[model samples]
Target: MTPPNPQDALRAAAAHVSRRRFFTVTGAAAALAFSVGLPQAHADEPADPGTVRQEPFTLGVASGDPAPDGVVLWTRLAPAAFEPDGGMPPAPFLVDWEVAHDEGFHRVVRRGRELAHPEFHHTVHVEVDGLAPGRPYYYRFRLGPWISPVGRTSTAPPQHARNSAMRFGVVACQNYPGGYYTAFKHLANEDLDAVFHLGDWIYEGAVSATGGSRAYPAGTLPAVFNHETVTLEDYRLRYALYRSDADLRAAQAAHPWILTWDDHEVENNYAGAISQDNLPPDEFLVRRAAAYRAYWENQPLRRPQRPRGADLRLYRRLHYGTLAQFDVLDGRQYRSDQAFGGAWARPGGDADDPARAMLGERQEHWLADGWRDSRARWNIVPQQVVLAERRSEPTEAYTVSMDAWDGYTAARTRFLDAAEAAGVENLVVLTGDVHVHYAMDVKRDYADPGAPAVASEIVATSISSGGNGAERPASYDRLTKANPHLRFYDGRRGYVTVALDREQCRADFRVVPYITTEGAPVATAASYAIEAGRPGLHRV
Candidate 1:
């Protein structure tokens, strides 16, 4: 049928705003349109049986991967008796959407239809397009009568727009047990053009085995009592608990997000077929499919996430006002299995074997092409982990996750090599998941001090996954000191705000005191700037 009436959508949405709820998740039976053959297992189940009968929705709403004319909106419609790991009854819901120029639904600009069904675990992803470029916009969702909380979004500048400066918040790894998302509150409040979730969007279900804990501020980390998240239900619970955080909701409301998956989004140091920390190969593909699909569903991504088994394309590109281009890469999928486990990685064993690839052949080509074709003044590769080469001095153990650039040394070298070939000026690597921040000159060969700096790497610390802000003194201090190319380093729980101007790109490392509590204030720990045509980063 036609999109649930725009007025109906607003009434449903307005009702949610009245509740003073920033994220309103509603679930109902006729959620999905007929004809999307749901599995029998899912069909014979009750719909919308959540504990809180008064509320029809489940979880909240979020948006990501924004462009000048489009952005991805997301939500999960949990079925009745939803358990942690799959096997819950199938849920089918018709997710209605609305976009307004004002938060009060004054000017309804776009309306759309999305199907939340069993085929995709009841999670809704609607990528709305044709929005005004370089301007802020408000949005929300609707069910039969229930509406989601109002969220805000903005698009990238259209191609013809000129001299338009843009600001974005960069971050990753917000583990529940490590701390709270207190930083999210400030990130939401801080005016920004968009948000870049570099990676570690969600930790897997097997925290105990990962040498991590489950005690977060609000509630226990969602877990599968019997096994890790090998099924849809396991992944569902994981997102449910994560979205429940008020800080996270506020951040989701503030701006559109550009996201990618780090190892922990599925499993620590996991790759195509192998998982770090000793996981069975057989348990992986199915597990990955669930994780990938769940991740795609819960986030505001485009049609790319319409899962084809376990593989979802998280790699995407966004352009901003001819000033910058962002290539958000996926680090975990399409990578070789962990070459070495834990602190002692073994990538050197058959490291040059062409068969061994980190980004696989396709992603490698895609990145290479992006470097060659980008016309923006700056080219940003927003991915996970650090890009600076590891320099060893024998003072301590320094092992690279074979799943990281370190494991795929040859591949990363190729990427840099292509940049050189493409003459891609102002190449910058935007990284996350190390739980430590750094600003370093990216040399094609980290082993050579005399080697020219071809680009810069700005590594963002955790939103709140690592230890106390000062806990990892050695990790930050020692790394910067030992590596001459490393200009700045800090272990803080916060995010980065990068402001671009015609003169320079200034990255202000903003750290929140803590996320384990509400009302954490944000401050700039340091700032670094890369002058136009400089080719390398410099401390400001």
Candidate 2:
């Protein structure tokens, strides 16, 4: 089957909806595509044959993609989250949502009713608009007398505002069974404009009970194939389990999120329609479609982000007044297969092949155009995988991780060269997916020993992926010494906080003492800053 053009896909999706019938969901027969061969006992039984007796908002509420005029509100009715169907009936139910200027909801701004269909797991996504820009708003969902916990969100500054600053909490790689989410509790209390989630939202693989510092709780796994998520229901259940965490939900309720996915959102280290396990393209595409749709249904994305088959238009731009221009990227969707069969090797030959594109030709051109047209003081690229040059051995004449940008050296060089040629200074790259903290300078050409730095990259550690990591890993000493552009490195479990303005950008490397148990204190292990027009980082 040929891939549908974006506009045609959107039109086809819209054609399925009938607003008069309250956005009718896909029928049960259609859902069977995701539920075939499942055990009857694990299925979500038709509603209790009566009214909803239990609260449907057990999974919590969230909002994202804030525009100057509005934001997108999200919530799924999952009274029994671990169940196959989120314990909802096969019928469509009415859900009411409202957005207000205050937490108390005394002053109502936007209020409306939308139907939740079991086919989509009774999830509701409301796009609330006509509000003031660069300010906070509170929202909630209701089903008759049951009301959801009020969630707080904010809009971006007006695109042309002359004086503005932006604060964002960058995080990624939260494996449920890795450890507890103590870092998220601290993140929820931060004074942030928005949260940049660079993927790995949920690990598609399963963990043994005796694997990490924490053990998998009983009943968390489904009765069917729970080793890896290969079906739509499997992916949905994984998301439901992750979202059931209180700390994660608190972080979602506290701020608007800008989310993008990495490998584990589907399968570990899988690229495009190719699986690392070497599954056939046609078979892998089916699994990809399931994971993609499940991802779309669970997150607070907008209409344009809706998945059609295995393709979704998730890459876009967001502006923060004149302070920053966010070119959120999707590196996985459009890319060539990893070189050297997706393993670490010397970085030359095929790795330097100009045809081995990472962001594909179209996205590369799009980013280059953004660099030329950008007017914001800072051009920030929030993406997965580190963009700096990282080598496994200090003496080896090579790089590691063909899955990272190092494997696409030509594309990386081209991207940086375009930014430099366009006279775009103040380029900041926020990265995740390495499960460690790294502050590096983006050299014009990593292969050139005398090349000048043109940008700064801040790579965040995983929230709880590797559990409670040591304060200092051996790689910290070796990699930092081997690469002078790499200013800092630490192996810890936490996130990165960034504050940007016209004059400078400060990044606080916040680390949690422990993720094995709850209530761990978070502290800034290190701090660094980049002054205006400067390309390297200064430890301050």
Winning candidate number (TM-score): 2
Q: How much does each candidate deviate from the true structure in C-alpha RMSD? A: 12.2, 7.2
Best by lDDT: 2
User: Mind giving the per-residue lDDT tens digits that candidate 2 earns over 399-483?
Assistant: 6778999888777988888898778989999999988988999886666767887899999999999878988886777787678
Give residue 413's lDDT in candidate 2 (0 to 100): 82
Each prediction's whole-model lDDT (CA)? 0.69, 0.83
List the candidate 2 regions with Cα displacement exceeding 4 Å.
1-50, 208-212, 216-225, 447-450
Clashing pairs in model 2?
47-89
lDDT of 2 at 78: 80
| lDDT of model 1, residue 118 | 67
The superposed Cα distance between candidate 1 and the true structure at residue 443, in angstroms, equals: 0.4
Estimate the overall C-alpha local distance difference test score of candidate 2. Answer: 0.83
Q: Residue 183 deviation, candidate 1, in Å?
A: 0.9
